[model samples]
Target chain A: MTAPDDTLLLIEDLTVSYGAVEAVRGIDLTVRRGEIVTLLGANGAGKSSTLNAIVGLAPRKARRMEFSGSDLQGVPPETVVRRGLTLVPEGRRVFSSLTVDENLMLGGAKHATRGDPAAVKADMLERFPILAERLHQNAGSLSGGEQQMLAIARALMSSPDLLLLDEPSLGLAPQVVDQIFDLIGSLRERGLTILLVEQNVAQSLEIADRGYVLANGRIELQGSAEELRASPEIQDAYLGA
Target chain B: MDIFLQQLLNALSLGGTYALLALGLAVVFSIIGLINFAHGELMTVTGYAICFALIWGLPFPLAVIAGLSVAMVAAFLMERVAFRPVRGASGTTLLLTSFAVSAILRVLFQNLISARPIPVSIPASLSGVLTVGPLHLGMIQLISIIVTLVMLLGLNLFLHRTMAGRAMRAAAEDFAVLRLMGLRANSVVATAFVISGLLAGVAGLLWVAQRGSVDPLMGALPVLKAFIAAIIGGLGSLSGAVAGGFLLGFIEVILQAYLPESLLPYRDAFAILVVIAVLLFRPQGLLARKTLVKL
Candidate 1:
């Protein structure tokens, strides 16, 4: 657990809706500096919606929402990214027509305000060797696993302080999933904070510092990773015997 | 052979102008998915500016600059007053809004100026023919082709090498995702419109030079042909739009040059028939790639 002053993101009673259909009801969550917090839920459990609201992609209302000591009320998504928070949206939404290099270039566009994009791009290419090999190829032509790596690498181009990842392993082979989770663990080891939304509950809890389980737009359980992993309710509902 | 060479030059010049116009429309379409029927009015605005500048005895180059500037301003205004308010509306709404803007501008020009064609004076040096080795070439035709080529090269570099240009391309692919990249949507949209206006201005200048006159309705045919070119090229592809423009120009020029006198009267109809045939064969367009829409 982190001290109150060290909290990187603080949200209270956050609600998201699509017209009259409430996707995420009032929920409070917090993440401190250098913590990996996993949000686990089934389809339509509003895990994605919570992440979307945090990044300002969805219409959201909250009693209070702050990131890095700044208010996020009505802040646009782009501004949210500029403020050192970025989202790697579900399904690896790479710009299909653009080249891998070009997609990475766009990811670092916000970094232009504060850092050297060329240096960051070189770092990304080095980190994701597969992306470097296919730098000039169209993003759509990349394999699913490669695309996922590119998506994660693209988000890192911004040098975000807190990363929001939605379903990073939504569709990958077991080995690829292992590789992705390894990458996530490595990212945390490098001192970056992450708020992860995943349906792979067991794998997610294995690496998460803390876990929250949401059902029907509300958080049904919240505890340290060890506590959630040992809970009978979590075992029967999410983990198979 | 000399006559053939002359016709080839004519076709190239006409094709360059059409390509420019089509490319302008394509740029806007790729970004906002708006066909911008009012894009033609931008040409009309430039045409009138050129007329006024020349009538005031300004130099031809100055007149061209004035025309381009006015067209750019008109484009900005159109986006601000008309299109911006309706951003994210359905395709039908945007299309009808652009049509409304077009109609209102045409009527405004008509009521403000004269409905009659106003003659424009080009320097003798520009309109005169240059002779070289058994072939005669119009100076304006050579200039238009060279200018269009240079503009296209510059645009290609901008789109490929620059960050803003990359942002625009990404916006075309997924606008919502682009916003998450921390780019101002308004700036990207404005850049697209500015480039569109610049192309319209230059193409309009070349077109008016060829016709030797300006009128409120002057934009009607060129815009219609450019729109057809955009459709034929694959509505949202930049290079496709250029290819479509050249193809349309080639069909029009070829039919005019070689058709029997009896068939010459149906030249426009024949050109459109060719376009329809092409569309029938490749419905997405000549250069269109499949786009994946995310859930």
Candidate 2:
């Protein structure tokens, strides 16, 4: 475990619930700066709930939740984005009705008050050339892989210090998934801290510096990526080895 | 032929007013997914303001401005006070809340002022008719059409070019995602109400000009027609509302013009029958696109 001082994001005793149903229960985790941390889980393991809670999308309570030393209690989702934490939501919730360019522009809207949105947009277009090619086209017209790319590019337009990605590889073809994982690896190389929630355990572990397995609203396992890959339980449950 | 042209112009002018009212309702509906039935009360409130302004010896333009301002303020208050509390409630609940609000406003107007019609003097310039070549047109009709056109153009530019306008459109798509872009929920919803109010105010002015009087219940029929227009256009589409309004206006005018004198009294009933027929054919409405509600 990283020291508390070095931790960029720290969550202590966090819980999330929807009405009477508890989705996440008393989880503690930390992501130090510039690390790709993966949360591995099954469909109902509360992975999405954890990410949603951090960004204020889900009902949550925590003993201590801080990002870069700033307390995150009662902060709204927009403020969370403004504070340099951006989430690429599940199923690539790209604004399908809007043009590709408009989606990118909206992504940069949060930073528009503080920085040059035009510059950020230009950078995103350069980074995701496919988005540039289809700038005038509606986002819905894009193929699944392309839409996924647009979703990531849109989040990057905010220039967030930390990126929370939920199921980036949910329904993509194998080759497209490989491309997305490579993109994730490259983003890490650029020093963006990432909290990745994924079902593709093997690929996530390959890029993740650390991994946590969640089951039934609790963290079942936590270790470095190599240790997780070698574990017999992980092999049996996720890898099918 | 000249009489036919005159009737067409008249129909177009009436259509313009209905279009404005429908557009207002559609704007509010698109953003919050609430069919704000009290939208008509905005017209009622504006009509009262105009009457009071004229009573105070204010000039016609100033009276119109007063009416517009009052309607805008009322719209903002409606959202902040009545609608905001019940936001995210069931569709039936929202509809009932707006209906209750409409009833309250009507009652307030009746008790505070007069239940009877209050005569409003139209400026002579507006009341006059203009004849050019073979065509004749009422100045008020011309002004109403022109104003509606200008307002529509302005609204189009705002929605297409401005950031706030884009945010409003995005809110229709997924309001939560819009918040993730760092927009304040209050500001976006408030903006929708403001626009709705402005449209209602202008429509009210035209409506009063045509009727030559204002009463506590003056907004009821026009608002109902506007609701029909919005439904015909597609509940959540702005352009559809305008199109639907114009279509409804044309249908009413045509029925009134062409129907025998004996059948003139049943024109409104016939118009509703036509709307019902159209709905039977296109249940989702004329321009109904599939809009996915986000989870």
Candidate 3:
């Protein structure tokens, strides 16, 4: 929950605006190696905005934004990807018309060595058996939870050091949501530093090492999962306790 | 029957040209999601570049290479200056910009040469005929059909099997997600325009060889037909574009054979009607394109 020496992602005073509308107002956050940092909020709480801004998908004027010692300030999305930061965008943005195999093939294009994409694909299928079952089927026809799993597996295909997942559980059955959280929890165990943004605060905290509560484009509360879970403010807003 | 064979050859030749040009258009469309209005001008740019190469005392093959290369440079410049920055600017803005790019390129060529069509002298080597079984195919038509088939096959292989091709397909499916693949969007788009110019240039050459003339406005028909063919084939699929082109070409030539003299004059109109039918019914085109996830 608290790491003193090793920091994987550090963002300080990040401000994002769309035209005159400010989406994120000067938020600071950190995620250490092998940690799952969850940003939780309702719709329009800037959770997605903060996650996106970290990867430069959102245009936020940040005073300091660094990932694994690299300045991700002006890098375009693809460059950000090659730098080992991958975002599984909201709504599982897989190429629907592409076959499951083709989607995975495109996922590995970022690597310097086009390493056996087939092997990576095999690994991905092993992790998500539903995808393996539908290997030849068009990606668009997959069920919502399966689509989300594919999205995560596709991101993993890039072998990213830090994975940003936005709303992976927004539209799925409760069982699927639990499966996704378990998957995220296991990914953290595998040494993947993750920035998970979700509306499901309690579920996210259950998996997250550290958690940040975002409201009105600012970090309303931040602490270890247990601290945040125990906080009276969060309990009142999120847990219904 | 001899004439029917000739017209069948005619239909294939026309189809080849249409497919090549439509491919160029489809490349841009799939990569950037722009129905590039200037793509026609890129074809015109091809024509004018060929005219220039001939004027400069270059050999025909060399002239064609130079023409295609110049067209690619022109296309690249257009993307870097005009298309890329405003790429996400909206369909209307892109449409207007593409038209403007086309108009500007057309005018530049006109002012550089003349305001009229220029005759492209075909080398004596390319002028001949071949007799095969029941059909006698002109060298021009035969060569056009062969080259076009080869190009289409090559494009198909490149798109499905090769890295760059799959990247193009990936870009077509989701340009934003392509960033996750660590491939630059600009490079993918530039590849599209480059291929577009190359094929369009080849089409310009085959067209000139067949017609024995080149004009600044020569690209108008092929461009229009390819776009229509692409729409008919299913707006963004490569094979569909080719299928649509051949279908349109066959339909046009066959109508000429079967229709009354008055209706023969409306061949272009008839071709457009086929496109309209496709749009009205199979809006996803021949292949039925599908998206991956909305939620």
Candidate 4:
């Protein structure tokens, strides 16, 4: 059981905007240490924007945004990553021209000061055996499912304390999606806190300890997995009841 | 046979200079998508630095190093002050900003130094000829070719072996994602500028050594040719830039050697016409890999 003060990421009244378009409007959220927290919403429902804002990719305003007891308000994305927060962004934007090994090495570059990069990479490749088998091939040659796996593996190379996964199952086969969720579960079991943003409501609830349903840039509902799974509103809107 | 050998040497030396400048331009462009028209100004910066160093009675090798250092500093300042503000602006805006910078630098050079050409006296040995069997090669030309090859080999090693180099290659493909992977965007862009500046510095030294003079506008015609060569090889492709530079060099040399005297004046025009023909066919240049940027 996690302690009350074991919060890994904490945000309050965080607002993200793009020019005149407000994507996330004054939302409060939290992710405790070593827990899989899911943020579920429809497309353009500010899920990606929330993740982007946290990583400093989107223009943001917030009353409070703290990570691991440190202020994360004005930190740039690069610095944010170095502080042990990693985001696997939407679309799995791997360096398509670079070899898989090269991609993995780049991912581990931030950890040069933190740990043995080669050992971290070796461990990552062990977790994703398919990647080790095709280490020299360009990342673009990988199938969509395989690419998603590579993306996750690449993020793990940083040994981040909190990993933000954005739509990891967006365009994968059903079986592949199951495998990705299983991997997420395994990663959680290894003590990595995850903030997963997904549209796969049924599976996400199954694995998530708690969830927040965001709509029109606001959290519409929040509950434990069992409570959210039984909520009629969640069942109707996301589970396609 | 002697004429052929001399012309071959000329082509290689001239092409080497063009390749250096084009690669410089392509490095920054590949990462940021900015066709920095002020790239030539870096060469001009080196030329002026060399002039000052020589005046300070610095030895020839030291002067060259001074020039390279100045060029690199100039590139850093250019990126920070001029380009950084207009970053993420429209393509036209970026192009205009580069032009504005080029114009400003040229004006500064004219006013601060001299509008007229300044003759730079090189060590007598640099202008000497190297005789091998029945052939004679200008010392400067031989040095240019060797230096160019060495630079290319060094660049190859950097790109393939180092983390920073791989980060640059990755930046060229997907810059945003690279930042997500923990590489600082500013540092990567700065590295590109520094490399380009170094190349421009080398090219400038060779150019001044060959011409025996430095002028504010000397970089204009050569840089235009380099820009054209970069386009011919496909913009943003480093290997293509080098290949395009060599090809452009060969075209000019062949034309200079073979074209009728009456047509000699039109050689550049013919070269441009050839470039157009190539673009009409390949469009992507000689070695541009098809980039399917998945949205």
The digit string of per-residue lDDT tens for model 2 on B1-295 reads: 8777877888889999999999999888888888888888899888889989999999999999999999999999999999999987889999999999999999998999999999988888788888988878888899999999998999989987887888887787778777777777788999999999999999998888878889989888899999999999989888889999999999999899899999999999999999999899998789874633222
In the order shown, the candidates' DockQ scores are 0.48, 0.39, 0.54, 0.46
The second chain of candidate 4 has a TM-score of 0.96
Write one digit per residue (lDDT tens) for candidate 4, span B151-184.
Answer: 9899889988999999999988878778878888
Candidate 3, A85-200: lDDT as tens digits: 88999988888877777777778764521346668778888888889899888889888888888888888888888999999998888998999999998898888899999889
Order by DockQ, highest first: 3, 1, 4, 2
- Higher-DockQ candidate of 1 and 2: 1
Candidate 4 stretches with Cα past 4 Å from truth are: A1-4, A110-113, B1-8, B130-136, B289-295
For candidate 4, lDDT tens digit of each residue in A124-206?
88999999998998988888888888899888888899999999999888999999999999999999999999999999999
Q: What are the Cα lDDT values of the candidates? A: 0.89, 0.89, 0.82, 0.90
RMSD of 1: 2.8
- Per-residue lDDT over B115-214 for candidate 3, one digit per residue giving the tens place of the 0 to 100 score: 7878877888788888888787788888999999899888888887887888888788778777777777778888888888788878877887888776
Q: Is candidate 3 or candidate 4 better by TM-score?
A: 4
Residue pairs that clash (backbone atoms under 3 angstroms), model 4 = none
TM-score of 3: 0.90
lDDT of 3 at A65: 82
* Residue pairs clashing, model 2: none
Worst 10 residues of 3 chain B by lDDT: B286-295
Query: For candidate 1, lDDT tens digit of each residue in B42-157?
Result: 99889899999999999999999999999888888889899999988899999999999999999998999988989889888888888888777789988998989998999899
